[model samples]
Target: MIDVDVLIAGGGIAGLVAAAAFVAEGRSVFLVDAGPGPERAATEDSDLRSTAILEPSIAFLTEIGLWPVFADGATDLATMRLLDAGGRENAVRTSAAFAAVDTGRPRFGVNVLNAPLRARLSAEVAQLPGVRVRFGCAVTGALARSNVNTVALDDGTRVHARLAIAADGRDSRLRKAAGIGVRRWGFGQKALVFAVSHPLPHNNISTEIHRTGGPFTLVPLPDRAGVPHSAVVWMERGPVAGRLHALDDAAFEEELNARSCGVLGPLRLAGKRAVWPIVNQLARRFDGPRLALVAEAAHVMPPIGAQGLNTSLGDLRALTALTRGAADPGAAGILSRYHRTRYAPVAARMAGVDLLNRAALAGPQPLRDLRNAGLRLLDATPLRRVAMQVGLGAPQGTVSGKP
Candidate 1:
């Protein structure tokens, strides 16, 4: 039997962040993951698919001491450009300047590929004396008592810890075993992510363009071999996208160009394409007696605006703070506390994203005009700017430090 202060299930972003946070607080952290395979990698160089770290969220991670390790490996996105298709307006543009003025931050956020970030986190965790990691280990069983959590491994060994956390993906086995259920639905769309080089420089600008089908996100990457490259998330109707993905590179790019409306002045494919069938999901129950869910296990938003992992990190942060560097193993009160901390923000964001998506993709001309006007007014007015800041995860009251 193995024992530790905390037992974390799933070694993805949320689990790693939670493990790292507790270890930094001098808590013995043990992580168990079924293990990651290269087949899941977005590109050959990165084992992680793709994820964006938001500004404030990055600050939180920095406070926990994980940012420096990622500095050299991540890309800083200092500006954002939002385009409204079938409309005529800039609506809003946010820059590091605006963020510094509005929130007193130098940069809003940094974008990093998953593989390197994951690797650095793994390496850093390995160096921490309080952190223990077991890859290639699957949990065959789990039991949470009032004082601790016991997990049975596939190999017949049992491990005990003060708490067991589920951060595995949306369909979390740990969550299932703990009686957690999630509401999941296919968005009838698929997002195809790949790297593309453009003749025009992205200029540190990450962009989101809304269309009838869905949003197309273009995030900047470093200049590669003197070519300006960007990471693209082109979302389209699932049936069409499935057929598009099955085609050869030339055919896929042709279809992608048709979807993008020549935004980047002709996109030249630079990496392997990865496709995700879009879905919106959230857990029915965030926790069981001793088991708690974070990240995709707890809630999953559509990939719009980098909500998936960011919300996951938020859950991790709150869980760490509420747990206060100690675990009663699978304590229900602690689990409830963790769930409560995450419930509001997670549910709010889920509804908000769904609303935005539905509104942005609405077919009715009148509703589109109303949403567009609201979108425009929100950006053009100071009152709306503050509201936008709050919607963007700034502290509830103000961007000032008092909160």
Candidate 2:
């Protein structure tokens, strides 16, 4: 029997970080992935997604000793600009920008490319004292019981642990084994993600353009080859996004520049394009028996507002704290606390994202006008500051500590 204090299924950033967190608390962990090595998975050619790491989230990573790696590669987000460029060309509405100064901070957050983040976290976890990682291996089956949970791997190995965490993502086998059901719905939209270089600098600002199909966001990235680059998330109706994804590089750049409304000046593709179906999902429960779900295994929000991974980190934060002092990391009490702390908030966040996405995707001109007006109003008032704080996943009442 391969025994460990905790068994984390899924070798994504979340899973690796969870293992690191547990090991930091002096617990033993076995981490497994059904895919290639972290280094292979994180290469720019493999994964094109980027995560905007908010201040608090960065602090959590720092506590786990993995921030330095990210800090070296991330681009700071000092401001956020939203433009309503949906509807007809003549009907395009207001544009607004929110600066971090309103929140008393020098910058709101930092955007880090996924590949490097994963590579760093994976490397760090691999070197931790009490963590064992098995890449390109999967948890083929799981058996949960009153006192312990055992997982069977494809290689005929079995792992016994006091707690099992299902970080395997949306199609989590561990979650199914734990009998946890999820409420999921598709938005009939897909997100096209890639990197781009603009003739003009972004000046450390992140921009989101709300158009009829969905939101087109440009998030800052560290300069490359003496030029400025940003990661792009272009959302559109399913078929439309598919068509756009099929466009030649020249055509894609032309369309991207048009959608951007010349805000960043002419833009050109800096990396390959990748598409993902947009969905909203929340597991019915965060815990089951001796198991718990974190990250996408627990909840998935639309790519809007940079909420997806941040919400996952929230789950890790709660789970790590709940299991910190527990003798049995997967004990009933600890699992229950994690569920109670995460469930309602996650559900609420999913609902909010769903509503916001609906507004962004609404077809009616009146609805689009209302949405744009509301965004303009919010931007013009002090409320935009509050919205900025909340949108960035900032803790309530957190003073930026800036005089």
Candidate 3:
């Protein structure tokens, strides 16, 4: 048996981040993924989604030495603008902009395309002496024992480690093998992800427009060839999204522009469109025996507040902190503490996001009116700042730019 401190299954961003964090703590790690390498994954047209990395998560990556490389291709998020168009012919009814300055911070967060971020993390992990990344390899099975957990790989290799963190995404083999059940439900909505170039600058602002269907978000991205650009996540009902996806480039661009409400002037497609169904999931247990679940393996929320990956990063952060200096990485006490600390917050956040999504999709006019009114009220009071702080998942009084 090849012994290690941590054996991570699934090679997504969360998996790679976990490997880097564990190695930074002087633990040997083996990471396996069935997909292509991060660099290759970045160049693929199918993986065009971008992530808005919160300030706290950026700091964590910096501590582990992965942020510098990712920073090169990232764009700052100075403000988050929310527009409600649910009332009256989908026109902008009410708008609120949450600025980092309101909280005495320079910027709220930054947006990075997933492919480049994955590429950088992959590159960094390859050079780390204590971490090994195995591409095109999948975790076929797992067994949790009293002292350690064993992972079976598709390539006929076996790994024995004090703990195995499942970052394998929403459908996790390790979680299933560990008998950790999850609560999952599918939203009839589908998200269309792509990049666009605009004549006007985004000014580092991320915009989310609420309509009868769902949110259409435009997140800032670094200029491409001197033209302003932003990544777009347009969510609609499954049938509508499918019809839109079939439109010609020019037709789709027109629909996209209208949905965007011309916030950044005219828009043109800069990347291929990728679609994914929206889902909500939360594991009943974060850990069992010598095994622990992190990232999507633990929970998955809709793309509403950029909480999906940020929540995953929270999982990594909590797990890394709990395991530090522990004699047995997989001690039941450590796993129990992780479950206690993480499960509630994750569940609460999931519920909150679900509520917001449901409100946005509410068919009743009275309900929609109430939802918009609540948002306006929040914006009018000090609760706006508090809400922004809570949404960012940062502690109160924590400055954004501080390391």
Candidate 4:
């Protein structure tokens, strides 16, 4: 039997970060993934999505010695702009800009591409002492005992650990093996993700345009070959998104430019496009027995306000703090504390994002008008600062483990 202090199932960004974080605290860890390792995964053509690492997450990464890897490629997001273009002509009706200065910060966060960030984190975790990383290997099952969990691998290996973390994904197998249930619902909407280069500079501003189907967002990205570029997450109804994805490059660009309202002036596809179904999910509980769930395995929200991965990092932060000097990281007391600390906040955040997504899906003219009015009210009042703070996952200007 292979023995370790921690066994992490899933080698994605969250799992990698968890491994590094635990190892940094002087714990032995074994990380496993069903897919190819980061080296191969990074070279793939899929997963063109980008993540906005908010301030709190950045601090956590820096503490674990993983921030420098993403520093060079990170693009600052100094401001966030919201536009209501649900008008009949698909033209902008009302707009609001929230500057990071209002929050007493220079920038809300820095954005980085998903693949490269995963690769860099994987490399950093591998170099950390007291850690083992195995790609193309999976945790087939797990059995929890009084003091340790014995995990079964697909290769007929048995590993024992004081704690088992399921960072696998929304459909986590380890979560199921641990008998943890999840609440899930789909938006009947899909998001089209890709990178684009435009004639106008983004100026470090992240913009989200609200119309009939959903919000079309343009997040700042590092320049490519001296050209201004941004990552686009254009959300629409399933059929509409499907047709757009099936369209050829020229047709797609035409439709993209129209949806963008020419705000960036003739956007050109800078990378391959991918489509993702939208959904909001939360695990019924954060932990069971000698196991704990983190990241997508615990909670999942739409790609709005850059909450998905940032929230996952928040899980790592909370878990790290709760288990800092523990002899058994997965002790029932520790897991229970983790569950109590994380569940309510994550549930609340998921609810808020769900409400925003439903509003963005408003179809009728009157409903769209109502949504626009609400945006105007939020922008005009002091609620704007509160909104910005909530969007950053910092309630009342305080960065808590809730993140």
Candidate 5:
């Protein structure tokens, strides 16, 4: 049997960050996942999504000494532009721009491709002193004792840890084993994630265009071969997205350019495309016995606002803070405190994003007009600043601090 301070049951972004964070705090960590190890998975051409790592999340990563690993590859997001083009003509009606400087920061966040970031984080975690990563092993089951939890792995290894974390995906087996329920609902929408190169520069601005089906967002990415590139998350109703995904390169670019409203001139596919179903999910509670759920295992939100992974980092932040210097990191009190500190805030954010998505999915002209009006209202000076701060994960009444 192997003994550790924490056992993590996923190796995605959240699980890797959890390992690094806990180990940075002088805790021993054992992380297991069912997929192939990072070295192999990183080489595979999967997980084509990108993440916008906001200021607060960057601070947390830098604190744990993991930011530098992928910093060079990150593209800074200096501004966010919201455009309403939900009219019948598919043209822009109202536009609002929010600058990072308005929030007293040089940049709002950094965007990184998910695969490379995971690869770099995995490499870093593997070398950390207090971490043991079992990439191909699955968490079969667990026995929660008063002090330590005994976890069984598919490889026939048993682990005894003070805490067991469910960083697994939304459909998490560990959470089910703990008898934790989730509230989940899906929109009849899907998002197509891909990279595109454009003739016009993104100018470090992330643009989200709201239309009939959903919002089409283009986030700045590092230049490729001296050409401006951006990551696109184009959301549409189920059948529409499927047809778009099935279109040939040339045909798809035609549709893509029309949807973009020529904002970036013309767009050419720079990479492969992948489709992801949109869903909103939250676990009934963040903890059960010695197990704590973080990231998708805890909550899953739409891609709007870049809330998915950033919020997961928030979970790690709260968990690390609550357990620091504790005699038993997984003590009932510590676990309960983590749940209390994270649940309500996460649930509230999920609800906010859900409402925004529904507004973007508005099919009626009147509803679309209402969304545009709301956008114009938020664009005002004071409200715009507040919106930017809140979007960057700053606490109420404060701006996001430097990392």
Candidate 6:
């Protein structure tokens, strides 16, 4: 059997980030992923993903030395503009200035494509002194006891660690192996994400224009061919997305441009469009015995308001604090405190995101009107703004940014 301080069962963004945080603290950590992740492509590469890096998430990553690597290749959104579209009289707009003045950051976040971020994170983890990643090794079995965890790899090797990190993603194998349960809810909506090159410049402002089906976001990216491009998360309700997915390029493009409200002056499709089912999965408990859940393994919500990866980054930050001063990386006392502090914050964010997504995606006229009025009122009030500011900075533990 092999030995390590902590054994992680996934090597995705959350797993890599958590491994880096522990390695930076001089802890011996082992990361095991079923297969190597994909590499980044040069121009307008979608590879089916994108995530927003919130201001506090950026600060936490920079503190742990992961941001520089991610930033080296990431697309920056220096500003963010929220535009209400459902044909409402308010037609409100909010910018980074709205989130930053309260949070003390220049911008609420930066938006970057997934492939580049993953490629960069993989490299950063490789260079960390104490992180050992074993790719192409699937976990064949797992057992957790009070003092340690034992995981068997398909390669016929066994590893024992004081604790196991479940960074395996939304449908986490490690989480299931430990007998942890989750509450699952589906949005009945699928997100069509792709890149679009528009005639007009994005002007570095990421826009979220809500429609009947759901929010259609145009996240600005560094220009390709000197024509401004943006990453789009086009949420479509029910069978419409499925039918559109089956449509020929010409038909699909026609329908897509019509929905854009002429904001980008005709959307020229770039990169392959991909669809993902939206699920809200929250582990009933984040830790059990010698195992702790991280990232999507802990909780998941619809991709509304820059929540997914930002929430995961926050998990890495909180997990880092839970293990900060322990002589042993996976001591039971440390793990219990981690479960305690992390549960509330993670759960709150999960619930909050779920609520926001439901409100934004509702079909009825009264519901849509109420949501729009709420955003407008919230934007106009000073007391509510300060309250949001304080809530945004609240952290689970030492390393800030979880919720």
Candidate 1 residue-wise lDDT at 54: 77
Give the alpha carbon lDDT tens digit for every residue of 121-221 in model 3.
78888899988889999999988778878889988998998999989989999999988898888669999999999999999999988876778999999
User: Which digits, one per residue and each the tens of the lDDT, describe model 6 over residues 173-257?
Assistant: 8888888999998768888988888999876667777656778788888788778888888887868789988888889888888
Return the lDDT, model 2, position 1. Answer: 83
lDDT of each: 0.72, 0.86, 0.86, 0.91, 0.90, 0.75
- How do all models score by TM-score? 0.88, 0.96, 0.96, 0.97, 0.97, 0.90
Residue pairs that clash (backbone atoms under 3 angstroms), model 5: none
Give each model's clash number.
Answer: 7, 0, 0, 0, 0, 0
TM-score of 2: 0.96
Order by TM-score, highest first: 4, 5, 2, 3, 6, 1
Mind giving the per-residue lDDT tens digits that candidate 2 earns over 355-387?
888988977878888898899788777677677
Any idea how many clashes model 3 has?
A: 0
Flag regions of model 4 displaced more than 4 Å: 395-403
What 10-residue stretch in candidate 1 is worst by lDDT? 89-98
Instruction: lDDT for model 1, please.
Output: 0.72
Task: Please report, as a residue range, the 10-residue window in candidate 4 with the lowest summed lDDT.
Answer: 394-403
In model 2, what are the clashing residue pairs, if there are any? Answer: none
TM-score of 4: 0.97
lDDT of 2: 0.86
- In Å, residue 370's CA in model 1 sits off its true spot by 4.4
Better of 1 and 3 by TM-score: 3
**True-vs-predicted CA distance for residue 83, candidate 5, Å:** 0.4
lDDT of 1 by residue, 1-403 (tens): 8888777888876778888887877778888888753234323554325677776687778878888866766676665666666443323222111232354544457777777677677777777888888778887778777776788877687888777788878778778788777788655878787888999988776777765567778888778889988888877778767887899988877766766666677888887887877788889878787777888888877777777788888887777777774535356777787777678778888887787677656556566567656656656666545643643456333443232
Which sections of candidate 2 miss by over 4 Å? 90-92, 396-403
Q: lDDT tens digits, residues 1-403, model 4?
A: 8999999999989999999999988999999999988778778865799999898898898998888976759999899999999988989999999988777889988999999888888888898899999899988999999989999999998999999999999899899999898888976899999999998999999999999788999999988889999999999999999999999999999999999998888999997999999989899999999999999999989998888998899999999999998888989999999999998888887887888999999999999999999999999887786777865558322643221
